[model samples]
Target: MNMAAVKLQTSVVSQAGKHTASVIFLHGSGDTGPGLRRWVYDVLGQNLAFENIRVIYPTAPARPYTPMRGAQSHVWFDRHKISQDCPEHLESIDSMCENLSAIVQEEIRAGIPKHRMLIGGFSMGGAMALHLVCRYHQDVAGIFALSSFLNKDSVVYQAVEDASQCPPLPELLQCHGTADELVFHRWGEETNSLLKKAGLNTSFHSIPDLNHQLCRQELELLRSWILKKLSL
Candidate 1:
């Protein structure tokens, strides 16, 4: 069933979670979440390997993304024309994060606590995951961001910094390829630092010779992490 609460259509993959955990994985620019789901299932040959968890893949809606010459495409948010310079578009992110938060709420309403779920993504989608989980005032199980980075100077980061008595941030497992020509490796490191600064428990892994993609090692690490999280 497609989740209509979000601006994009969502595809779900049901897994057995110990009392039912959940994961929401967003897709990158110009890609659908279902496509990512296929790669995850067919290419990776995995099922999330948990007892009873639902994996959610959400597709990005068509929008006037500014990065690719402002052409219409699927993207979490509009990448500034200057490309990672400054003046983060908080309004757009705010709307999207609201939708993302709603998705989590749907999961919670379905009988999962904030501690029994994790939100993750790759590339731009990863950026969205990190941004929403950290910036928006929401509680979730954890976060796993791959080849992703945070917009340090954005309102989202400001929100993280401004909240003096904020609720505890979720644990994070973030990884990036050293040779990532697309998102740049340093952003990943920067995001990790920011999360730590906010007192969030985050683990950062740098994949050597890795590019703007995932490796088998990365998948294995993710699998191990998920299993550990599920306590299986």
Candidate 2:
């Protein structure tokens, strides 16, 4: 795959002063970087803003979605099905991970080290975050996945298990809702369990009566985590 093909367009939320750190957050399927940026401002407001940390929201390339029956959508990867039972489509996944790594590398060249950056997203984007951090950029500062999961027998577990010396996985904050019908809450819990078992610093939160969407409580936790992880 051409690296330039996956170099995505982004919407940035600039910080107040010189940026000391960066947050590269991906949007869910069908959502653009600008759309997610708008939602973050309108819904999250000040909860996710910082004085010296720039937030970059990258838009995925529009492609044919298998689950959506060939409908074109902005997705990090094509999936035949969106359930934990179905295996992940690694062909597109590996490509997207490389794409995300390019973004991280750009940040590195801009003076922000991998250890000073966080990677994360919601739903499908969250799944991409998992692959990007775990399989490609394990040295990142942290990861946050909202209402997301990994496929059965994920390479993440294998990467951890197969390492001769245990890799230094980043701190992870994962939140899921009990009422989520699309991606089941159990899948998120299982993801947390697997990550912890692989010795990652993982934290899982369950929102009662919540669905496949964000809530104030989740954003508050994310803000706290970000402050603790990447604050100057």
Candidate 3:
């Protein structure tokens, strides 16, 4: 059990209604826990029926993104060169999966059922969400990946296959910006293809004219999907 107790900043919003589920948001690279307050308050908070669901935003530790970047930012794992078949990148995925598993476990201990939980993130955080949902053994309600890519090499494929044999796959919804320059649009296409090939139920959406960033339209779409999944 090589685990580290990482401190995470969290907030909860409860309304005068039956709570049906909880969503844990993992922020993208360079964003802090408090910085995501707007997303929680404006986007998800306003759109979702707060009476039935709650949201948690966790901040990652600040770590050097690269040996040369010098500047450190909040990230689940070290940011490395983007490659479809990079071994080092795959290793980073493993490390992040471990961290995400611990976070999810903590949430479960706090009374959130495994099937009532939704894990998601944006950009690099999106990558982590995809990795954890595929590797984690429990059944999650759904996974929301925004402006992200999957590490779809042979090693990752094997991991997904093995996990599927033992545990049920969770529903997956992926949203990508067609005009994203930071992570090429092709990455999203490839991720969808890989998941579909593996026989997982997945939905993919391409936001038109969007760059490597989130927009109102995309946020609304995510909100609708999450609510529908939770039946709230």
Candidate 4:
């Protein structure tokens, strides 16, 4: 793990009216920003082209993924396994998070306040989003994690514990499928529970019989949630 900054390729969905807010959504392992751009619109049933919301989709740099036996993948960070017990690759995680912070800094320079921006993603992307927002960008408007979970020993938990005084934490919205075999429903539940206990305003939604993917209902809820947060 080299700590050198990597510039990620990004696809932006510009705002219609004014650039009052921004949403940076990360893609899961092996997925690119352009790939997620299409899927997001297709799943949400509409482009995120909200009146004042600019959506940025960033592609991860290709790196050797451990679970795939060192095969390269466009993942925000690498890990030994998806289990909560697996140790996180902090070197790569920190390097990638710094790259992501560059994107956030650019938005801030353009006049978007941290409180008017939302960060989120699906699956592995959601995990990275949790790390980024929790460890670095706590002043963000809110965070959304879909079918996602953090490791039991994640730095996010430690960060919360190390805080001398509770800051105004971001509101969190997490949605998981009851039948998700990949990420497991219980993981999402436990993650949400832990965050809530850490004093975050968390809302969890469960969809019956769904699997490791998103559905119309989930996207509908996500769209509404983004709207409400950005409108504030």
Q: Which one is best on lDDT? A: 4
- Clash number by candidate, in order: 7, 0, 0, 0
By the lDDT metric, which is better: model 1 or model 4? 4
Q: Considering TM-score, which of the candidate structures 2 and 4 is the better prediction for this target?
A: 4
Ranking by TM-score: 4, 2, 1, 3
1-232 per-residue lDDT for model 4 (tens digits): 5644888889999999889999999988899998888887888777767888999999998988998999989988889886988888888888989999999999999999999999999988898998899889989999999989988878887775444157788888999999999557999999999888777778999999999887889988988999999994
lDDT per residue, candidate 1, 32-86, as tens digits? Answer: 8878887677647774445677788988777777777878887777767534567
Q: Write the per-residue lDDT of candidate 2 for residues 154-229, one digit (tens) a residue.
A: 8877775554167667888999999999458988999889878877788999999999888787888888888899
Clashes of 4: 0
TM-score per model over all chains: 0.88, 0.94, 0.85, 0.95
Winning candidate number (TM-score): 4
**Cα-based lDDT for every prediction:** 0.76, 0.84, 0.72, 0.88
Over 4 Å off in model 1, which ranges? 1-7, 16-19, 162-167
Better of 1 and 4 by TM-score: 4
Candidate 2 residue pairs in clash (backbone atoms < 3 Å): none
- Please identify model 3 stretches exceeding 4 Å from their true place: 1-3, 39-49, 67-70, 90-92
